[model samples]
Target: MSRSDEEDDDEDFQAESNAEEVSAAYKLFTHGAAGPITLGHLRRVAKELREDVPDEVLKDMIIEANGGVKGQEKDVGGVSLEDFESVMKRAGLSFG
Candidate 1:
């Protein structure tokens, strides 16, 4: 079935938001010596974001964006640059 114009607009907005989030993620990584970002970093970035996204939501977004993993909490194995980018692209955020 074809999508309505409003649906299409929403999709476009989502895409834009994702890009902004990705940019923010990258900036965080760079700020931290251009290294991979840890879950801690993600939390900090999320909190720094313009929108006040809850910790639970951020955690869920991280898991979902990176694909489910076992024992991810306290893993401390920072996400690779590529993975970080991918997660931001898949999350609900905006750079503006």
Candidate 2:
């Protein structure tokens, strides 16, 4: 195959892998919930993982994921799967 074809194949593979990873992360964090993930969900997941992250830190995470807009942190509802994926990408975080 040509070099261009190889690059396309690699890109396709990476996309698929990223999708799978996002799905897995969503399930794990949301605990199979159908709705968006909230602060409660994150706290439960962190507790289950034996992590001792503080509530303020968790809130900060949500705020940061929601574009870090000043004075709007208190209005955050929850994070959808798409937003979660975007935040993870922007933060350079991955399930792998």
Candidate 3:
């Protein structure tokens, strides 16, 4: 309950919060987004988010996937939340 102890706890909390914020910043988009996410689909994605997606991050994932901004293409590996349930069913990751 000392002042130094409180200060240390505050520092730890701040560090954790900052780390979470930084991680969130790098997350360009999330799953269950209502449509496909390919390079060709960036415009739709922006619309779904109701804001402009980060140019750098969106461009990078699309380029990494070799997508051409098309709106209908989904990740074949089914890594997105939209397909995650099915994938978990196949992989048996589901607890239920």
Candidate 4:
């Protein structure tokens, strides 16, 4: 059994497609001019993309693309101690 000429073309096409995927992801994920910088930007992108995705899913994707933390990934039941400390510090109520 051997490969056909068309298989080689398909591989080349796939490689080009993969490169495009990376380019687009990098542009969007790195907060380029078109990325979400403020709540308004997020709202605008959400409005534009809502038809292709559910609200919750789109929100999560936007967060991930903006390099958001994955603090909620570990457990959905309760917050971690470190998370609580970070939140408190941000709120200017940290004990230490």
Best by the lDDT measure: 2
TM-score of 4: 0.31
Question: Per-prediction RMSD in angstroms?
Answer: 7.9, 3.7, 11.5, 15.6
Ordered from best to worst lDDT, the candidate numbers read: 2, 1, 3, 4
Minimal lDDT window, size 10, model 1: 87-96
Tens-digit lDDT string for candidate 1 (1-96): 457988878878887777666766577655746655556666667666766777666667556645655344565345555666665445544322
Summarize candidate 2's per-residue lDDT along 1-96 as a digit string, tens digits. 999999888888887788788888888878887647778988998899899999888878877765654344465566778778888777775433
Backbone clashes in model 2? 0
In model 3, which runs have C-alpha deviations exceeding 4 angstroms?
29-96
Model 4 misplaced stretches (Cα beyond 4 Å): 1-5, 25-41, 49-59, 62-96
lDDT by candidate, in order shown: 0.61, 0.76, 0.47, 0.46
Looking at model 2, residue 63 earns an lDDT score of 72
Q: How close is every model to the real structure, measured as TM-score? A: 0.43, 0.77, 0.32, 0.31
> Mind giving the per-residue lDDT tens digits that candidate 4 earns over 1-96?
347778877777876765555445434533455422333444455566765445456456444433454434431122223433344345554232
Clashes of 1: 0
Instruction: Record all residue pairs in model 3 with backbone atoms less than 3 Å apart, i.e. clashing.
Output: 39-69, 40-68, 40-69, 40-70, 41-69, 41-70
Clashes of 4: 0
Supply candidate 3's per-residue lDDT for 13: 82
